[model samples]
Target chain A: MITIAVDAMGGDHAPVPEVSGAVQAASTQDVNILLVGKEQVLQAELKKFDGWKKLPIRIVNATEVVTMEDNPAKALRTKRDSSMRVAARLVRDGEAQGWISAGNTGAVMAISKTVLGMIPGVDRPALAQAFPTIKGKPAVLVDVGANVDSSAQMLAQFAVMGEIYSRLVFHTESPSVGILSIGEEDHKGNELTKSAASLMKALPLNFVGNVEGRDLYTGLTDVIVCDGFIGNVALKVSEGLVDVIKHMLKESLESTIASKIGYVLSRQAFKDFRKRMDYSEYGGAPLLGVKGVVIICHGRSNDNAIRNAIRVATESATEHVNDRIEIEIQRWQASSTNDPEV
Target chain B: MITIAVDAMGGDHAPVPEVSGAVQAASTQDVNILLVGKEQVLQAELKKFDGWKKLPIRIVNATEVVTMEDNPAKALRTKRDSSMRVAARLVRDGEAQGWISAGNTGAVMAISKTVLGMIPGVDRPALAQAFPTIKGKPAVLVDVGANVDSSAQMLAQFAVMGEIYSRLVFHTESPSVGILSIGEEDHKGNELTKSAASLMKALPLNFVGNVEGRDLYTGLTDVIVCDGFIGNVALKVSEGLVDVIKHMLKESLESTIASKIGYVLSRQAFKDFRKRMDYSEYGGAPLLGVKGVVIICHGRSNDNAIRNAIRVATESATEHVNDRIEIEIQRWQASSTNDPEV
Candidate 1:
C-alpha cells in the first residue's frame, strides 16, 4: 500500500482542510496516512468527520508547529520535534513513501534536503510545476523556484528529468523540450541560455530551439526548463496576468446585460480555462532529483489541493521515477562526455 | 537644442514612420533631428510630410541596412555602413546628443556597447522599460531584455539606475523598489533574488523587500529589478494576456445590443485601461549604464513609436541621466562598500 505523510498543521486552512483532504484521499484508496501534528487539535477536527477513523487514518502527535516566519534552516535545526520536520524525517527513515507539506516553502525545501537528501548523482533538487496547455495536456516547467545560477550542464540535466516526468505522467513518447529566451533566434539570448541551447541541441531528445514567453500558452513544447529565478518569475508573472485578465473580464461583463449573457454562453470555456490554470487540481510540485518523492504543496492549500497532492505523490511513488532518473542522468552524462560537440 | 539621431532605414515601417516621427519631433522647439539613412529615401518620405522638414531636419547618408535575421555581432562587424551602425557611431562620436533605433535590437545593443563603450564603473548596461500602473503612475522595469542571467550585484546596480531613472523621468522621489520573487515572504525566491534583496536592504534607497508578479498591476512598487530572461518573459506574457482578454471582450460585445450599449458607456474606462497598458507610447527601452544615451525601439515600430522614441531620447539626453547615473552608482558603491554589516 502507498503510504503518505501529511503536515496537518500547515497551510492557510490548516488541520481542517488537511484532515478533510487526507481523510477524503484515504477513503478512496488503500493508503495509510501518518497525520503529523497536535493530536488534540487533529482529534477535535477528526471527530467532525463521519466515521473517517475506519479509513486507515491515524494521527501521529507532535508537540511543536513551525510558524511561517520561522527561518527554514533554524527551524529544521532546532524544531527537531515539529510536525513538518518529523513528517520529512519519516520519509527519510523509510517509514513513509512520500512526504507532503503545505507549510512555508523554505521550510519544506530545507527539511526535505536535510532529511531525505538529493538523489544520487543529482546535483541539486529542482521544483517542477505542471501547467495545463491549451491542448489539455500538461507542460512541465522545471526549476520554477528552486536552484538559481545553474550551469549549462545542470540545465541539460533538468531537460532529461523533465522529459522523463512528462513522458511518464502525461504519457507522451516524444515530448518536445524548449529553452526560454528573449528572441526565437539562435544567437538572441545571454550566455547561459545560448550555451544551454547548444547543449540541448546536442542531446538525444526531441529538442526544439528557443521559445519565447508567448509559446507557453501556445503549447509548442511539452517541457520547459529554465533557471529557478526565471522559471519562478515566468510562473508568477503568468499567474498574475491571468488574474488581471479575469478581473478585466468580470468588470467588462458586469457593465452590460448582453455581455453577461455572452459570458454565460461562454461560461464553459472560461471555466475550462480556469481549470486548466488551476495548480490545486494538479497537486503539489515535485522536488525533482530528490532521493524519494518529495512534493511541495502550496502553503495556502485547501481540502482539494491537499488531496490532489497526495494523489500525485502516490502516482509518482508507484512509477519509481527516481530509479529511472538515476539511470538516465548517468547514461546522458557518459554519452555526452564522449561526444566532441558537448 | 537637443540633437537626436534617428535611424530612418531601421524599423519594419522604415522611413515612412521614421521620417514622419522625425518631422513630428522637430515640431518641438528644443528638438533637432539628424535623420540617418539613405538620403534619397529619407528625403522622399520627408517631402510627403505635412510641412515641417524645413525646420531642423538634416539627412545623413548610410548605404546599408541590418535585418533582424542577421547575427548581431557578425552584422555589426560587416555592416559598418548600415543606417543602424552609423546612428550608433554618431552617438559615440558626439555628433548627436542621443540615438534612437526602432530596428534590430541585438545589433543595436552589440553596436551601442562597441561604439559608445560602458559608463565608468558600469559592468553591463540594462534595458529598462517603463510600464504604466493602474494607479496612473509609472513603474520602471529594469533589465527588460538585457543582461540575462544577471548576478545580485548587477540587479543591485539596476535598482540604483532604475531609482535615478524613475526619479528623473517619472518624477517619483524615493520610489519603492521591489525584487520580483515567487513568494512575498522575505525568505522566499532563488539565490539571486534573495541576495539582491539583502543588498538592496543595505542601499540608501527605499527598498521594499519582495513583490509578487500581481503587485505590478496593483502599483505596489515603483521599480522592479529582475534578469532579462525573466523580465522579457514577464513582458511577453503580460502582453499576451492583455491581448487575449481584449479579443474576448470585443467578441463578447459584438454579439448583442445590451453588450453594445455597455461597451459604449464603458468605452472611456476601457480606453483608459488600454492606453495605460499600451507599451508603444513609452517609445523604447533605454540602454542604461552606457556612456551615451541610446534607446532601442520595438522591431515592428511605426512612425508614432519612432517619434516617441526620439522624444524619449531627447528628454533623457537633456536631463543628462547618463552622467547622473555614474555619480549615483559610484557614490552608492563607495558608501555601501564599508558598511559595518559588510
Candidate 2:
C-alpha cells in the first residue's frame, strides 16, 4: 500500500481542510495516510468525520506548527519538531513513500532537500506543475520558481525530469520538450536560453526547440522549461491576469437581461470549463529530482486542493517516479558529464 | 494646435480606419492632421465625408506602402518612399510634433531610430504599456519587448523614462518606480534586477525599491520596469490568461439563472471594469528615450485604436515628454559620472 505523509497544520485554511481532505482521501483511496500535526487539534478535527475509525488513516504527533509568514530557514531550525519538517522526515526515513505540504514553500524545499537529498546526478530539485492545454493535454512546466540562477546543465536536467513526469502522469510517449525563449529563432533570447536551447536540442529526448510564453497553454509541446525567475514572473502574471479577467467577465455579463439569456444557454459547458481551469483540481506541484516525492500545494489551497495533493502523492509513489528518474539520470550521466553538450 | 502625423498606409485596416480615425480626431479636437500616403486613395476615402473641406486636414503625397509582412529593417531601407517612413521624416524635420503608426512595430521602431534618433544621454529606447490597477490608476510597465538583453545602465534609463511617462500620461507625482525582482528582500532576484535595483535606489526619483510580479497591477507602484525578456513574457502571458478567464467566466455566469440575474444587476459596473482592464483603450506604447514623439500602435488596431493613438501622441508632444526624458537622462548621467551615487 502507498503511504503518504501530509502536513496537517499547513496553508491558510489550517487543520480543518487539511485533516478533512486526508479523511476524504482515506475513504476513497486504499493508501495508508499519516497526518503530522499537534495531536489535540488534529484529533479534534478528525473526530468530526463520520467513519474515520475504519479507514487506513493515522496521526503523528508534532510539537509545533509552521506559520506561512515565518522565514523558511529560521522556522526549519527553530521549529525542528514542526509538522512540515516532520512530514518531510517521514518520506526521508522511508516511513512514507511521499510527502505533501501546503506550508511555507521555502521551508518545504529546504526540508525536502535536507532530508531526502538531490537525485544522484541532478543539480537542484525543480517544482513541476501540469497545465491542461487548449488541446486538453497535460504539459509540464518545470522550475516554475525553484532555482533562480540555473545553468544550462540544470535546465537540461529539468527537461529530463519534466519529460518523465509528463510520461508517467499523462502517459505521453517521449513528450515534446521546449525551452522558453524570447524568440523562436535559434540565435534569439538571452545568453542563458540560447546556451540551454543549443544543449537541449542535442538531447536524445524529443526536444522541440524554443517556445514563447504564449505556447505554455497552447499544447504545441508537452514540456516548457525556464529558470525560476522568468518562470515565476510568467506564472504570477498569468495568475493575476486570470483573476482580473474573471472579475471583469463576472461584472460584464450581468449588465443586461437579453445577455442573461445568452449566458443561460452556455452554462453546462461553462461549468466544465471553470472546473478545467481550477488549479486545485490538478493538486500541488511535485518537487522533482529529489530522492523522495514531495508535493508543494498553494498557500490558499482549499479542502479540494488538499485532497488532490494527497491523490498526487499516492499516484507518484505507485508509479515509482523517483526510481525511474534516478535510472534516467544515471543513463544520461556519463554522456552529460564527459561530453557536456554545449 | 498639435500637429500629429498619420501614417495612412500603415496597419492592417489601412486607409479606412486611418482616414476615419483622422476625421474623428479632427472632429473631436482642434488638431492639425497631415495624412501621409498615396494621395488618390486617401482622397477617395476622405471624400466619403461631407463638410470635410472645412476641416484642418491635409494629405502629403507618398507612392509606397509597407506591408505588414515586410521585414522591418529591409522595409525601412528600401521603402524610403513609404508612408510610414515619410511620416517619421516629417517628425524628424520638425514639420509634425509627433508621429503615430498602427502598422508594423519593427518598421516603426526602425524608421523612427533612422530619422528621429535617440535622445542624447539615453542608452536606448524602452516600451511601456499602461495596465489598469485596482483603483482605476494606470501602472506603467516598461521594456515590453524593446531590448531583450538590458545592461544596468539601460534599466536605469527605463526608470527615468517610466517616471516621465507616468507623470505626463498617467499623471502620477514623482511616480513611485519599482524594479521587478524575484523576491522582496534586498538580496533577492537574478543579477540584472539586483544591479538595476541598486542603481534605481540610488537615483533621485521616488524609487519604492523592488516589487514582485503580483504587485504589477495592484497600484502598489506607479511604474514597473524589467528587462524585455521578462517584460514581454509578463505582458503576453497576462493577455493570454485574461482571455482565458474572460472566456471561462462568460461560461460560468450563465450556468445558473439566478447567477445570471445577479450578473445583470451588476452589468454596468462590470463593463466599466472590463474597459479599465483593456490596454488598447490607452492607445499605444511610446518609443521612449527618443528625440521626438513616436507612438507604436498594435498591428491589428481598429479605427478607435487609431483615434486613441492620435490622442496620446498629441498629449505626449504637448507635454514635452521626450524633452523631459532627455533632461532626466542628462541629470542621471551627470550625477553618476561626477558624484557617483553607487
Q: Write the per-residue lDDT of candidate 1 for residues B1-342, one digit (tens) a residue.
A: 788999888788787878888887788646888999998888788888777646798999999999877788898889989998898888888889989988888788898898889988788999999875656576888888877778899999999888888887777878999988877888777788899999898888889988887677666799998887778888886775566556645665555665566566555556655665677787788999888889998877777778788878988888889988999889887776766667
Clashing pairs in 1: B17-B303
Q: Model 1 over residues A1-342: C-alpha lDDT tens digits?
A: 989899999787788889999999998866888899999999999999889868888888888998888888898889989998888878878888887888877788888888888877788888888875655577888888777778887888898888888888667779999987887889778788899998888788899888888777566789988888778778777776666656654665565665556555555555545655687888889888888888888778888889988888887788887888999888877886897866
lDDT of 2: 0.84
Q: What is the lDDT of candidate 1?
A: 0.82
How far out, in Å, is residue A339 in model 1? 7.2
Candidate 2 residues lying further than 4 Å off, grouped into runs, are A251-273, A336-342, B250-274
Worst 10 residues of 2 chain A by lDDT: A260-269
Fraction of real interface contacts that model 1 preserves? 0.34
lDDT of all predictions, in order shown?
0.82, 0.84
C-alpha DockQ of every model? 0.29, 0.37
Scored by DockQ, the top model is 2
User: What lDDT tens digits, residue by residue, belong to model 2 across residues B1-342?
Assistant: 889999998888899888998899888976889999999999999999898878889999989999877888899889989999889889988899998988877788888887889899987888888777765688889988888879988998999898999999767887899988877788778888888888888888899878888777778789998998898888877766666555555556666776666456555645766677777788888889878999988777777878888888999998999889888788878877897434
Question: Which candidate has the highest lDDT of all?
Answer: 2
Pairs that collide, model 2: A254-B263, A254-B264, A255-B267, B11-B103
